[model samples]
Target: MKPLALPSGSRWSAAHLCGLSVVLVPTCFLAVLFIWPVLRLLALGFGDEAGPFHSYLRVFTVPAYREAILTTFEIAIAVTVLSVMLAYPVAYLMATVSPRMARLIGIGVLLPFWTSALVRTTAWIMLLERYGILNSVLMRAHLIRHPVAFVYNMSGVLIGMSHVLMPFVVFPLYTAFRGLDRNLVQAAMLLGAGPLTLCRKIFIPLTAPGALAGANIVFMSALGYYITPALMGGPAQTMVSQLISFNVSEQLDWGMAGALSGVMLVLTLAAFFLCRGVLEKRLKRRVVTAARPYGEGLSGRSGAGWGMVIAGCAVMVFLLAPIVIVFPMSVSASPILMFPPHGLSFRWYHELLSRPQWAGAFFNSLKVALIAVPVATVLGTLAAIGLARMKGTFAQILEGLFILPMVVPAIILAVGLYYQLTPLGLTRGYWGLGLGQAVIAMPFVFLTVQATLRGFSRDLELAAMSLGAGWFSVMGRIVLPALMPAIVSGAIFAFITSFDDVILALFLTDVRARTLSRLIYENVLQDVSPTITAVAVLVIVLTLGLLLSSLLFQREKS
Candidate 1:
């Protein structure tokens, strides 16, 4: 049955009177900033800019364009499969291990998750280069005489995509595994079910939520991947996103760009529906009662258990190695970038300040992030409060609309924002790009605040109302202070999300406002600068500090 539209309270009571104003303000903001721009882009594509079918027709007719679409599908699917295989065992280990051990291992898993995806991709680029670390090691071992062509090829694209998307796979599976009942397994074992049968019938069904949801997240996210493939993939490996960007910026072919984006959007929606259906059928809530001994639990130290532990450690190493490689590369004394450095020097770090372009990009990212973060934090916090207090389809629909920006490939938002901003001369500087990023950052902010609200006590709200405090007074004196940790975490996340962006920067910024990620992106393509590694290291440090602060705050709140 559909949920009723309002909560079980007086529509105008003090407790609920802050009410829809909270929803309306953010809803209106998203409407202007996100929905309108996307709808505009779609209209322009199918509109009379030449003809409705002009661009759509080209995607179908052109051989290279057709291949780009097919290759994108292949890469996304491969990334989905590889990430799950690598992440599942680690997630299981975390569920079964001691609390302290799980915490230690979780930090290893999350460092890469919280750090910039583009930074990680850049590190992989350096590692896989002709004179890069992997080749240097392989040659020293007499494995091969010449460096393999890893970058500007399909192999490089796959590795980058897998590294960046692995965390999405790990986090959801960890959640589901932690929530599973060990007692059920003991009950099944007592009923004469063997290990294989227990896994096939009980465990797999229980974990369906994480496996299916995480794969859908990875595959959909990969579908619009641009920077990794643009840098790592060869000319023959052009993707739908690259195709859209090229047509819009280079060819002035709006129709074709729109058609390609429309198709990608459709593909994203289709995959989500198909995955959701499977998850629902397999993961329906069920009652299973059982008792268990402490020593003999969900995962025993049988041969199979030992095998999984070994595999989980290996997966953790694979996930962490690429991110860890960049720090050593940054301080190398070689004029050219090198790993296993001949000598360590801070020259590249100093050079960042001396170079005008690098300084400009760094400051530009800061400016954009500063302007965007507070706005996203307020709007997201308010939306979370509103949705938590309300009920039914209207609230659900509004929440879904806010999250729409996250579900669509970022390339779609880039195209739409560029089109909407250009006509008003808003594309040249920080305001346009800042608004674009606020849209991008909204979901992170909303989700963080929403998670905190789920566990909040309604009794405090009721007490304040009984004492005759107004909604605004209750919010100012009670709720805001209570939610300080989550609010701050959400703001920090919004800041990094804007700062680390490159897709919108590629489309929206001119020479005056190119962001840090854009500069790294442009430099990696033209030349492998030592400064690129230095900048990545600096970003890694800043992001880690921010992440650690958020974690500490959450711990204190708990």
Candidate 2:
């Protein structure tokens, strides 16, 4: 018996239908939750009663709004510069160290990176406030006559924002360093180049693009940042995100909020596109040099002077200080935060456990993560698979569309979703928040699965199908098994994204429905409590565990 073949047109139609089926859910999900809300936001901004562009005109003409916009730019640029300056030394250290030592240093960098931004900001507050740990230590040692004002100022804002954003610079610069040609460096040294000269002539030139790329990310992220500045900076340091939040929540001015979000959205997308261009060029250059394995012909140690090592180590200490300080602070018997923490006790831990709000919020976060992660995983995995099968300009466009949630600011999404969902009463439950989180989480899953698919062999599927296996059989037996590790890693990331979310919870959940992060934010805003220290430590531990699990899956995949 022979198998009957369908006509070419019929086969094309079937394939097209299959493609649509795969992408349908994710596309609709993004459209309703993300695109529609954004569109509505823009509509509100433009359709203001005063005039067609009244909101936008107000953004530029109004003194307070104008200053806020200028302040946002100034802070973003400052943070970008600070992040790049601090990150270079750390990146250089990571690139030059032994693999084991590098991994240890990586943990220090990632502990803060993976930890909630809110937690980090809180930790900084405890460290830098008047009579806080750092000031206390300084006064005890007679380094100062008084407790200096370390927070609630521009200095505090810069420190907090820079610490959080620096990791963006570090990773990219590290990659660039790893990709540097060791032979070129050795040759330059043999020709009597000193460390400083070698750095100026070769290292700086080669790594500048990566640093700039990271700077762009830092700047773009800093532009929309809310938690750090709102908590750490004073009125003078007010950013656009805070302004948008204030307009929406305090002033009940949706038009102004929408306008601010539009400007932020435009700037973020522009920066994202520019960064993509640089990265694409950098990747192309890397491919051209693929004959040599990265870090090839390089010694474990470089000609880095003691000064470079000290700078690198200092940066590492700076990165880990807030995290390290929180542990002892959490255990302090004293009510006030201080270095060495007087006597050791776990009263804060006890207090945290005793609070119903803490426990309720913890479980609420879990509930949302449980809902978001699975939905994100399934939709992202399907989207990845469908996208992999697709070709031409449409697929390219669709790929960009899929990534918009990540590129757009969280505040914009939070505000927009609140607007779109309030009318339908969807904002009243965990369901809406969970779905909102899924919008952000889906990109991580999509990118991970899509990367895995790039290395997958389609011939295996073809062979199975040619042997009379169905599509489901091929996917179940071959594709899914190959993609499992990536799927798991993606899910872990999705969970983290949902668990650490405060912005979404702020708008999406009322008091009863608040998550752990939202509760922490409230505590920070209302008053500093010893219980928050304990909570921060717990959050750090949980985030670390999730990150490590993701790393293991990545290792398995590799």
Candidate 3:
């Protein structure tokens, strides 16, 4: 669609006023609920009368806080490196195989991506438990005489985080490979290069930019991890985010929390720009120049071709293991959350069905998503329309303002909203949590709608307007129908993003406003029961259905 035409002349004129009207709801929504709240939290860091930097000194000097800072970066680096390693071959296979095979393995890779990180973390705990399937297999085969301790440790944290983050790495690499030229591999082979030699000297170097980009994504995302570490890790594994939460909720130290949050925000912003800066632009151009159709030059040798495919399959299985393992575990007759059930049955699932708390969580999640998604979709669509027609610094600034929720970590938002909302008596109810979720979910809708609108035309709208159709009629009859698919896509994603959230809910949810993720977190920490397995299975299946629906929608669009 063509960009919407900007109103001309004075800012107070009717046309300009109308355009500004489109910006009011979202801008004010983000301002009062999102931006002002964050600004308030940042200001609170200096509430200490000792000095402006007093809270900073405390965070840096305190051993507990110091350790969280160090642990955050350490885990982020490890997660990024491993994600790159595991994801590369699968991405390569996706780019090289037939479309059907690509789609099959791609779903395997995406199963964990679409599922909640909370669910995946829960699944990992079960998978690595002493009586879990992994240990049972090893024990029966004599690989080990006893089950190993895997849950509640750094090992479990890594496994859970890696499963969650691998998809972030895969997507950029897959996009990069889709644009890669195959002739480089063929040329290298024709020049008498062996498989390893060609891979190292030609393919690896060409895709190095993609790897770097993917690593940046993994690192930044992992830096803000809360649920995985909280559930799967020990005391020593606490990250900077958990430290912030602890300072606020347990210790009642908002100043220190704000200071620590400030440090994180600065670092996150710096890294965001660094990752998206000039180097990324150059890399994008290279990827595009390198782009070619799949399967042209992927098969150079019997050993190398089959070996890479096998590696990819293994990696894909690793990605899907946590999601797939939960199904049978859910039905296991053992009420103690063990594997190799005393017998096969649906005992846990039946128990889950019997719980009112579980039902409340389910309803609460739907309630939040239902309230948030539509508001986000409409305002985001309006923002997209306004942003489409604006120009220069004004447009860039507005666009970035809307995207701040996505760029800043959820921990910061949680802290900000708590400090700001509590003062106004807005923190205790569903409205508070719903508004926060809508702000976070808003950017998702805006970006997706904008993406589709980039290729869309408003010529039909112009034609209808000229033919004397009113604004509503044009919107109702022509423009909305054209953009409805994009709206639906964005709303679905926004709903999932809101529904799968744990960090924001942790800070904002009250007794009556509890969500599914909160319930899962509570169960993991206190109950350690088999009902979590049933919950995980249900969540995984719902996510799978969403993924398939998205795929079918895309297929239809294409």
- Per-model C-alpha RMSD: 3.7, 2.6, 3.4
Model 1 residue 377 CA deviation in Å: 0.4
Off by over 4 Å in 3: 1-21, 284-287, 290-294, 297-302, 553-558
The lowest-lDDT stretch of 10 consecutive residues in candidate 2 is 287-296
Question: Candidates ranked by TM-score, best first?
Answer: 2, 1, 3
Model 1 lDDT tens row, 347-404 = 9999998999998998999998887898889888888888887666777788888788
Candidate 2 lDDT for residue 197: 94
Highest lDDT: give the candidate number.
2
Kindly list the per-residue Cα lDDT of model 2 for residues 1-558, writing each as its tens digit.
Answer: 975556775634445556667888999999999999988987788879889799999999999999998999999999999999999889878877778888888878877887898989999999999978889889999999999999999999999999998998998899888878777777787999988898899888788778978888798888899999889999999999999999999999998999999988998888888888987787677542434423554444554655667899999999999988898889999887767888999999999999898999999999888889999999999999888877667778879988888778899999999998888887777988999999999999999999989999889988998899998998899999999999998898899889988999999998888999999999899888888999999998898888888887678777
Candidate 2, lDDT over the whole model = 0.87
**lDDT digits (tens) for residues 367-451 of candidate 3:** 8788788888888988886777665576688898988888788989988888877777766667777888898899978998789
Candidate 1 residue 186 C-alpha distance from true site, Å: 4.4
Poorly placed runs, candidate 1 (over 4 Å) = 1-18, 48-51, 186-198, 285-300
- The TM-score that candidate 2 achieves is 0.94
Ranking by lDDT: 2, 1, 3
